[model samples]
Target: MTEYSEISARLAALPDAELTTVLQAATVGRPAFWAVRAALDEMAGVGHIAPGGDVSPTTESVQTHDQASGGGASGQVGAASAVPVVPVHPAGIPASPAAGGYSSGGVPTFESVRDKVEQRFGTAQGMGELDRQTPAGRSADEQWEAREKAARERLDQIRKSVHDNDNP
Candidate 1:
């Protein structure tokens, strides 16, 4: 009935690949993530921290030594507290994924490649009418193979032309 619950439900329904994407997205631009992680250590009876060790944040209840004095402590505590060493995927890498599990010009995972394909072309359902025009039971895969061969042949011709131009 609540917003969190709704989000949780929707997240639950998604397949694993989509879930991975959402989890990856949530970590971005969220400095608070590191603070909570530090707070958890204190909750497990870690009263004192090193001069400058990692500190996680917890709910408002997990107060530090300075908090009892006044409202200054309150300023520090909240949901977005815990911070991690590496931001999971911090820099150089991108937030919006291209394809697959592989990042940074790497080959995409199968699902990521499929997702890209669907985004560029229409969905399977959207292509259904066109597919029906093909012989029944002749899958999309079959058509793709034929098309790929044709593309390769065309690419070979282009390559030969370029090679001849440079050499002659």
Candidate 2:
């Protein structure tokens, strides 16, 4: 009488070899793979699987002046006095929103600095992420790991260069 009942009857008739093949293709842990798993689970009279949940992206962000602020007014507008003048880079000038704020441009704010960096460098630091394999496809995790590795390597390079310059 129900849609699930029809599927259950069909699955029950499946040969052992065919069922194994279907399970192999289900991809229990992959995206969209879960839809197949859920269906298979229903066919096998399996109970609910507690959603393992999603893994969110971990950003590699350094502290800005706002983060160090201790005052209640720090996170709001007109908190410029408390806002730290964060350096755009180790060698570059500090971010300043100019006297007129965004109304007039001199030294840009942190948001502007990020935009300019992207414009000059292109997306994902020119890592060519979209050109890589999808997570469901092979090499997806490896490509992401490679990007993180490259960033860490660049940070190490920056640290070393600054350290070397300090002595000279």
Per-prediction TM-score to the true structure, in the order listed: 0.21, 0.20
Candidate no. 2 TM-score: 0.20
Lowest-lDDT window of 10 residues in candidate 2? 57-66
Q: List ranges where model 1 is wrong by over 4 Å.
A: 34-168
Q: Residues 124-143, candidate 1, lDDT per residue (tens digit)? A: 66677676667763676687
lDDT of each: 0.53, 0.50
In Å, residue 139's CA in model 2 sits off its true spot by 1.8
Query: Residue 122 CA error for candidate 2 (Å)?
Result: 36
lDDT of 2 by residue, 55-94 (tens): 5533222222233345335465323343333222222324
